[model samples]
Target chain A: MSIPGIRDRKIEDVGLQAGVDRLTEDQIQKTIKKVLKGETGAKLKLYAETCMRCGLCAEGCHYYMSHDKDPSYAPVSKVRQTMWEILRHNGKVSPEFIYGCAQIAYTECNMCKRCAHYCPLGIDIGYIISVVRRICHKLGVVPLYIQDTAHSHSATMNQMWVKDDEWPDALQWQEDEARDEIPNLRIPLEVEGADIFYSVIGPEPKFRTQLIYQAAVLMNETGQSWTMPATPGWDNSDMAMYTGDYEVMGRIKRAHFDTAMRLKVKRIVMGECGHAFRSIYDMGNRWLGWKMHPVRVMHAIEFYHELLEKGQLKIAKTFDTPVTLHDPCNIIRGRGLMDQAREVVKAFCPNFVEMTPNREHNYCCCAGGGVINCGPPFKNVRVEGNKVKAEQLIRTGVPVVIAPCHNCHGGLEDIIHAYKTGQELKFLIDIIYECMEKPDAVE
Target chain B: MNAAYEFVVGPLAWIAGAIFVLGSIYRLVSMYALAVKKDYSSLPYMDLKYSLRSIIHWLNPFGTAGWKASPWTAAVTFIFHICLIITPLFLLGHAVLLETFHGIEWPTISDGLADGLTMLVIAGCIFFIIRRATVDKLKYITSGMDWFVIFLVLATFLTGFAAYHQWLNYQFILILHILAGEAMLASIPFTRLSHMIFWVFIRGYMGSEFGKVRHAKDW
Candidate 1:
């Protein structure tokens, strides 16, 4: 049942409701205070005092634009509704308020960091929302699906429930599939000292096995020294960071870094996953009180660009389709790989068109930052809230859009399908694989 | 000078100065200590190059994505902040007062230029009011205190302009202008106006995160 009008479409979420039911008033209040006093420092204090509520960040937010310029959807207003809400209540958090926070933080925001960039003061509303999610996580009032994924990160060390044996099996299956084309390809697993420890998100093994297959083919054709671990830490992607389970988040990062260290690899090369790269490079490292990665890390965009630069990965055919590039927020805005990604696209896709606000200035797919992991209940809200993105894609006037990140593909696919823009999305690798020269395959 | 004028011009000035300087220093030191205590990792990435780059870009009008997003706000904000900061320091009247009171003097702007800057600040404040009233985002985010802060700033410039022009009761307006300026100074470390001091730290932290950690330009 939707509790509309009073609280603005408070949809029933079992995870949130159950989590709230399990908590007492005392527990909720104490949890909030604990997180506030222990976890936060001057950054929170400065943001709180410095915010003039100027609302200039509103124009940069897709949710604000898509929501018919609704005042509440403004980035600062979202902060007011969640973080400021907690402050106003002074830690006496109610079930209903916590519910609103979970929805707004987990579903309403993609945490794209666009608003942070758009803020004249460089105030990170995404970081503010993460603190809210952190409080909600402690209160045990998290949205169900993402919390489930976080639990998967906790228990199995992977987001999917793939067991000990399934990881290597999935890699083997992808290798066998790729071997059909390359005829001498191998997805080497658990090599002791490969230069690149190629890691990926959980979805690859469960369903998007083709991404793994293509990455393996790229590795094989380039004659690269890379390996996929058979162990639990092979999944570099994490949902725990989004779920606000910092302990689990820290553990996940540790496991990933340790796996690479144990394998004695020179670097950890991640698949086309933005959030995972963010986890390893930016967010997760800081959680462990470190400024640099334990091992060097590379995203697929950088890896491919390196290969192309070295003439290792040769382009066999230029893609004929009129393609446009969707710069994912994590890599482009968060990590700054816009020029490299565009270079790779220019190398392969001859008929490439640029979006209006290309590179770091591009809008986020509503499905990122674990908003998509919040699951089917909030899909409409996610789809409806990114009309600006749909319009952005449509304005490119290209049938094929290339997204180099996994979460971007997930979010853009939904937006395209919902808007029925008749646009198709592909990974940069998909086009790269289609157009690049393979070892032994003939057209 | 009359008693009321003397009090504002004498003891009140010293009190406001003491509070502004001491309070701002206290806030800065306390904030730094807090960061070191709980967020030590955040401090490690405080790259001077990145922080300077970020601060310089933000200080430039329309240099940031946020500024360029709405050119009108950027224009008003840059004009307002620049005039608000400049007119007080560079005005011939201020320079004369410093020379008279403390045997200190610096380069000063001509009265005509000072008049223009003061007017720009007042106009910028009016522009902000209209924006808050019209724009839904600004309207929702703004509170009663926010409105008061803007009006407080506006009053300082308006009274100074009125005093300079001798619009009505020159002595009273001049005293009012001095008091308003004092109040704004005192409010800096106490209210939303504290952004003046916090901007350095915040910009530096964000720059470090983007440039040193994420290898991106925040601007």
Candidate 2:
């Protein structure tokens, strides 16, 4: 059965056209059986048995609420279609069923775990959907684009596949841009024993090179000792973690941590990305058998919080434009940085108005959980599924929306365009860069 | 006592109690035995005081943060859980039975209070049944097992109410009440009613993980 609401957009855009063509029925069954029987344990059994199917969790799901209360979009329904089906069928489900499971688990649900908060039983539906993704990944039937990104992590140790030479070149280019202002600024490369090793996602170099320049100017103005590795591990983003490619996820996280260890930095401070922070601190590190990161890892929000609290960075002027904050699920809900994020935003923007449901209770931007990585074939679903978020943003009546996470930036951009909300989206750093008083300017 | 009454409230009662105790223990042990992945990330903050506080915060349906999300459902469900527990443990009839069985008696609510509590439980069950039957989202996820448990609780309460007022054949209704109550007990560890035992572990884990590891106020 064809997935409902999937437009005729290019499957090639998602990287699924080539990778999923060779999947056979026998392979699908065997892989599903192997994963469910081998990977799962009593926790899965307990959740399946304990859920009362009360559907009070329906309110917690943005997809279900946005889709006019469509039952299929409910968190439990997502699991019922995927993991519950696998268990009921004893993993002998047909390829068509697997195809549907892939779409529901990957494209339909964001795996944000918001519903788990509403769940009286506290069944982590996100974990259950991820188990389905793992089964699909083992069967080699993942969506095109995300799987391609996973393959990129496997082959290049970074999602963007930035060549070894290109990595340093990008850093040098950013350094040149920062030098134009400071005249003595340097994007410290591989500086051993640095106080901080700054990492960013792949898109930082690929598309948003100016963010690097902005971060460099901030680092230089603060007079903090920091280094950016001109190597494979500089990109902390891991799409493989979302694709259920544990081996690749483990390798990516190991490379990230090992790079920090190599630089001998006291800590690793990552840029404004939610999933990457979750990857290193919550998911990937544990998968690699480290209960915690060997070096302390802090999101840019926390780093900025410390800076402002310590009088390291001063606000020249608060942004006068009415603005609102969009909390990324990984950072706000997955981690507990909502207050710190708000503190940082409040420092720069005086006209800060909160979205109706702010902080940990905020709706996901629909681009997360690798949903945006599924690419254009699923774009309509992503936009329509997050219509509630778009409405929330529109209701805020703020001229600008501050989205701290990269995926939220991308996802909200789409929602603004699709909904014609005429709202501008900005990263917290963008506003900080615009409003902060540079120390060098004092001279 | 008649043969049927003797059988229903005697050996069957002992068997039901045994199953309730052993079954609960077995399920709890099996669940606790499952290996939870250790959180390796060094906590930025740890507050055991707040973790314990979160349990009370979340359990309060009217005052908790989650209450705002689904006020009606939370209110109804909260009342149902309270009545379900209190009516069974502190009701005058159940206390009398306990005294007769083990020669031990605890404080019991007045007969009027017991009747009122039983009425509330029955009303709560009816509200849930209508919700499961009518609400679009709830109807989609509602399973036969869910309805079965609701009706089972309803039957236990309805029969107990009838036996209390002597509205029906007293011995027969009493026997049915004992059977229904016992069946509900036996099903608790195996069915969705297992939440009765697992809620502590699940909510506690969420509290500690969110409160201590993430240093976030979940409530």
lDDT of 2 at A421: 96
Tens digits of per-residue lDDT, candidate 2, B1-219, equal 599888978998888888889999998876655533222222222345755666777777865445667888898888888888988899878888789988997888889988998998999999989988998777766668898899999999999999999977998888899999999998888888888887766566667666655566565
Predictions in order: lDDT: 0.87, 0.82
Candidate 1 per-residue C-alpha lDDT over A1-443 given as tens digits, one digit per residue, 9 for 90 to 100:
11222167787889999988887767778888899899888888788778988888888889988989888888898888778767766678677778888888899888898887788887888989999999989888888899899999999999998888998888888878777788888988889899999999999999999999989889988899988788989988889999889899999999999899889999999989999988998889888867778799999999999999999999989998899999888998888899999999999988999997888789999889999999988888889999999999999899999998888899999999989989988998898888898867633
Q: Number of the top candidate by lDDT?
A: 1
Worst 10 residues of 1 chain A by lDDT: A1-10
Q: Which residue pairs clash within candidate 2?
A: A14-A144, A14-A145, A15-A144, A15-A145, A16-A144, A291-B40, A291-B41, A292-B40, A292-B41
The TM-score between candidate 1 and the true structure equals 0.97
Q: CA shift at B85, candidate 1, in angstroms? A: 1.3
Query: Mind giving the per-residue lDDT tens digits that candidate 1 earns over B41-159?
Result: 67777888899888998887778888888888898898889898999999998888889889997889999999999999999999988988888777766777788899999999999
If candidate 1 were superposed on the true structure by all CA atoms, what would the RMSD be? 2.1
Residue B208 lDDT, candidate 1, scale 0-100: 79
C-alpha lDDT of residue B74 in model 1: 91
- Work out how many backbone clashes candidate 1 has: 0
Q: Can you give the TM-score per candidate against the true fold?
A: 0.97, 0.94
Top TM-score hit = 1
Task: Give, for candidate 2 chain A, the lowest lDDT window spanning 10 residues.
Answer: A1-10
lDDT score for residue B206 of model 2:
62
